[model samples]
Target: MQHFAQYDGEWQNRAELSCLLDILAISSRMDLRNEITKEIERLTKTLVVFLQNPNVDRNKLEQTIEQLNQLNLTLMSSSGRVDQVLGQVDLLKCLAQRNSIPGGSCDFDLPAYHFWLNKPLAERLQYTQSWTADLTPIKQSISLLLQFIRSSASPNTVIAKSGFYQQSLDSSQPAQLLRVSLERNAAYFAEISGGKHRFSIRFMLPADTERPSQTEQNVHFSLHICQL
Candidate 1:
């Protein structure tokens, strides 16, 4: 294909290679395989917090342990190291989104905007201060998250899923996010499939769904790899 023809022969371009590795990183997300693969990262972080505090809030701490128990189910399919890195990235996104629920119709609320407009300047300033205190770190995390988003970014799913990287995909449509690059690092793409003719990536779907039939190959994705 014309797209892959660009890097068909040269594999030593470090910049190109780095980009490739980063591409592979997000490729895991596009196909939806890595969403659950991020358990190791999540558990390790939670474990640290538990140890540090010695008395983690029981309800919240219990949640981490439960998730850790599911880690094996999520990680069984991929190589340990490769999967771990993806999981760490997902963990970062998870940390960013822990309490916030995902939704749309944002920025400003019509009724609320009118109400705020009627408020005095002193109240507006106080509201701004409160909003900034609560939202600034989450905003910063989102900025960092953008650097890790490789294939494509969808406004719908700001959080990554469960794989080594987090992800959120359309439940009825096989949405794709692909990133192509000439440069990559060998560390990320280890073994190179024992020198295979070509390498591609794919992922598993979440086990439970609202409409099981919807995901029985009805809404899934594939990441095709091309060498140029």
Candidate 2:
């Protein structure tokens, strides 16, 4: 969706086509709908427990739970695999097949796709809307879940001595995600790696034509151990 937003004005409609292919590939591998439903259920249960806590904001908690409930209902109403509707579109199926090969989706290889892309912007957008309508539920669910998870943890200032840092994770409360924030103009970037028990971060200098080496200077950044 971000890509779609970024390239919405262009003639190629690359984002729209790529989005379709991504949805098809993802849905073919697993039951994404079921996994999202289960995650929503789990998060909802966790939020319900917070409602009784005096320190937590009841109004906001209730609102989030309500949103989750609505999203859950929308997801439940969406029948079959998420890509089932997209798979029925012949043009998209052909495009997906040709997209796997280098230079395979050229105008000569897919005249139909070329024709579709050449349609008026309004017509192409309308078709894009219809093709992606069924994916709305899953998209909204993921957006909300991520929003909540990211906000669950507050950022803390931490320093990595000699550009390296390591921390042990609590087994009882494993993190869903780890976020590292640095100054926009900083010369170094963070490389994070981890497993269930621990995580490490290394700040490396950017190199254009050579391997990046870790900076020897201490690096300070904001870290968020997001758990929900």
Candidate 3:
């Protein structure tokens, strides 16, 4: 499931960026410099390879590459201005530590954070907005990539006999991800897994909080083998 894993990773990164943007909105400051820089570097490297692929839309890829290069230049300036801005606000690290404790972040746990929270909402939003501006390019690129990958496949209605289904994959067109859409109120969730040669899906009931058990009844769902 190498292709699936790669697509999953991009999705996860996009989720992380979204979470950061949300947190930044309410807080005056947070040390997300390291995180942003790391992501920028990773995205830059990936985009380089993505741009080389002739199969992808050249116009869109060029636009993304332009945005990435511009952002990279700004962040990598020798003056180190962005680094300094990030160094002053490490509140997120402190808050994360407190959140990991038995109880959530409380005044006694993160007094400094509490102080920041008391600031005017407008001021906090402005500061966070400035910081998150650096991430806009990466976010945009990931969104485009995900949209392209998803649109590459058409969903097929399939039935899982006795809660199980398997299909042999065509090596010529390897899938990037297996998207399974079940009924909104279905009693069970689909557990999908497979490799380059074949794939399988099994509907399982949420037996307990820890693990789900396979269902005995047959299941029906729509499957999309995304390949881009």
Question: Where is the poorest 10-residue window by lDDT in model 1?
Answer: 186-195
User: Best candidate, lDDT-wise?
Assistant: 2
Q: Give lDDT: candidate 3, residue 91.
A: 73
TM-score of each: 0.20, 0.93, 0.62
Question: Which candidate, 2 or 3, would have the higher TM-score against the true structure?
Answer: 2
Q: Write the per-residue lDDT of candidate 3 for residues 8-61, one digit (tens) a residue.
A: 243443334335634444333543444445655665576678777879897887
Clash counts per candidate, in order, are 28, 0, 1
**TM-score for predicted model 2 compared with the true structure:** 0.93
**Ranked candidates (lDDT, high to low):** 2, 3, 1
Better of 2 and 3 by lDDT: 2
Expressed as tens digits, the lDDT of each residue in 1-228 for candidate 2 is 545634545444866787778877887798877899999999999999998999999998899899999999988888777687656899988888888899888899998888887777778878887888888788899999999899989999999999999999998998999999999999999999999999999999989999999999999999999998
Clashing pairs in 3: 31-89
lDDT minimum window of 10 residues, candidate 2: 2-11
lDDT of 3 at 184: 96
The deviation in Å at residue 49 for candidate 2 is 0.9
